[model samples]
Target: MKRETNRRSFVKLAATAGLCTLASPAVLAGSHPEQLAENEETNKIPKKSWYPLGVFKNPVLESVFLFYVGSTWQRLSDVGECFDTASRIDEANDYSWSDQWIKTGNRLKVLGDACLKEHHEFTAGESYLRSSTYYRAALHHYPDPANKIVKELSLKVVKNYKMALKLMSIPFEAVSIPYMKTELPGYFFPAKLKSNKKAPVIILHAGRDSWAEDYLWVAQQAVKRGYHCLLFDGPGQGKVIRIQGIPFRPDWENVITPVLDFLKHTKKEVDMNKTVLMGFSMGGFLAPRAVTVEKRIKLCVANPGVLNWTASIYNGLNQIDPQLLPLFQAGNYDLFDQKIEEYMRTSSYVKWGITDELWKYGVHKPSELIKKYQEYNIEAVAKNIGCRMMVIDGTGEEFSVGEAKRLYDALTCPKDYVLFTEEDTGYLHCQPGALAIAYTRIFNWVDKYIDVI
Candidate 1:
């Protein structure tokens, strides 16, 4: 069949990408864009704007802090140590967050360098992973789209990730997945796939605006639990967006389908029937959307399940002006934009949010972004998902208030609705603060259905 040829062809092109070396993070990340694309947005969301998430008072700071804290089980984060640095940040200063975090990252990188020189492989790897994690937090609020510091910190993330990979006990590969006109960057942890046949494969999909390395802890957990894992930067994410300028597309089945092909071709021992599509954050939307069309997956996990991104956007629009949604629906775009522009002048949250969404969606105007997101809704095809589904809802979801249950209610297939309360550590969107409990429940549910043998 046509799909068969695509699978074989991917392995051929992907093999030429070669196994990346520890000294070559640039090659692993990908070549630089011919000319950097312009990012018109600025980080207008002020410190402590919306603090509903957890721990930290600011939403951005809370998310970034948990982005580091979530990895502590793998030794990639030191929660107590981070709290020390978190205290030194000056909320009145806009750049204070990145400055303190990047400083901590720099200190850890120096420690890693000395440990590597002393031949303490384990200690060096820990230092490198922790350093990479801190650098990642800094990137979240780092301003100036054209600043070289963005690229500098990005490369540091990849470099330290590679360095830590060198010291890992399991096999790790810096892989490239061939897509439409280019390749997608990925990490392949084969685990014991070759010797232990029938190994289940977990494909971890990153959220909007996140790098694969940002969620390396997810792959670490999967591999630790005996699953072959793949973490990749798809269109409009990580290097693909920054380096290649491809924006996000709604038909994620087009992306997930090819990834399945690549896995089937390369890892002969993997149990395709036991495949689990585990999505994080925005991936809650992307994963369910992909499963509606891509049926090869046997199990699908939507953490903080989202039924519709456009609906969520409309929710914000409604609050701004009860007439805003009606204006958009009536196609009065110029007037709608005029009103939105007026609102953006005063609301940092609205300004940064709309600007960030425009950049990620790769559209010039907010109207176009709305049209693009319209393709991302899963209501029409919810029944098309043939695989087992688990919809994860959280206690403190700032963006998606009731969307998870909405998705659960819409699905006609065999499904379960999971609520992550304060007790479950599934407090926020992806349960970054309580990663261990999140992963434990997820995999444990899979154990009940999938036969390892």
Candidate 2:
């Protein structure tokens, strides 16, 4: 038996998921198949309630559960019910996780609908938010983007999130950011502080697998601290990938530049001078990558700073029984692709990760995904980042092990590196179970550089 290093664990994460599409489930239920591991830069997201659930035997499902359940702190989910659902859902009995999550979401939608009928908007909104978070989490291990449920759940996520936003007592609006022959969809929540002064801004960015709405946790906290929050789905994220059909672009500065340009036109009192760019998950890389050129951001936060995302993706290549790199070097592309796909059959996480990324990136196969990712790194431009930077990382990272330190060491600008240890219950990527602590640390650090309020 081989010692599964951080990412090699993803191979097992697949079988741990044993997840199947909504289109087909019977064939995969209770059948855990082993998979090949290919690490990406997405190990930084997980949990709903901010308390990690170690009840599940499978680490992949553990991560999925952690991500959505940790949403309690954001008021997007109920931690108690999420725990009950996890307990009832058999971890090894594959393919039922998404279905069960949908059931829970449906139940909440019912309650929310009743609340709305009775004109209790606040209660209704809260229920809808939880419903949407469940629906969003359901997509975690769901393997096929072509499946109707993928789009169905995505629509439900936005629908519920919007309803919740509309019912809230905050200044909110939907925004369309002009891009190349298209527009990026986003949301804005102004701090609306009592003072007439412009509020400092915190631009929120979510990485692969998370949508624009998934970033509400950060925005919720920022708004409380009197910061105007801007969240947008870049190419390959949120509505961009779902509706407009745009793939990811390596030059993310193009994405952030337009966002910064649009802030002035928002007609709100936003302090552009104190703007902050904070990235989550794979976004940890995207945010810093953007600051390399867009200097308007006074503070840049990478939850786990990443160096060469391409190198990070292939970090565990040497440990595989038959290395994937050699196949590429020998031009045995078919075999290389076949081996990658073999994981799809064995692991739910691999299936979902590969398929979802392929669709988001507008690539046909796994190899093409790698080719596309090769263009998404900041090592060459790290020195060009003029803004103050902060790097965050947690121990026991599932995907990008040690990437934060690698990125922190590459910077030439003023920087800070914060490590979350297992003792603090922040061992998993992004400290999913300790979000309040995560945001508190971030805001306190930002406060040192700028007067956020």
Predicted model with the maximum lDDT? 2
Worst 10 residues of 2 by lDDT: 19-28
Model 2: per-residue lDDT, tens digit, 1-453? 453442344454332212211100111121111111111234422222223345665555666677776778777788887987776786555557888888899999999999999999999998998898888777766656677777778888888888888887546888888887878888988885776688889888787766778778778788888888888899877667766678788788999988988897764589888889988777888898898898888999998778777775564444453478788667777888898787566655556666767887799977777678788888889889888899988665545667789899989988999887555656566666678788778889987887533
Off by over 4 Å in 1: 1-57, 193-196, 347-350
Top TM-score: which candidate number?
A: 2
TM-score of model 1 vs. true structure: 0.83
Candidate 1: deviation at residue 342, Å? 3.0
lDDT of 1 by residue, 71-188 (tens): 6766777977688778888755656878888999999999989998998988888888888888877766554434678677877888898888787554688988878878888898
Local lDDT at 224 for model 1: 74
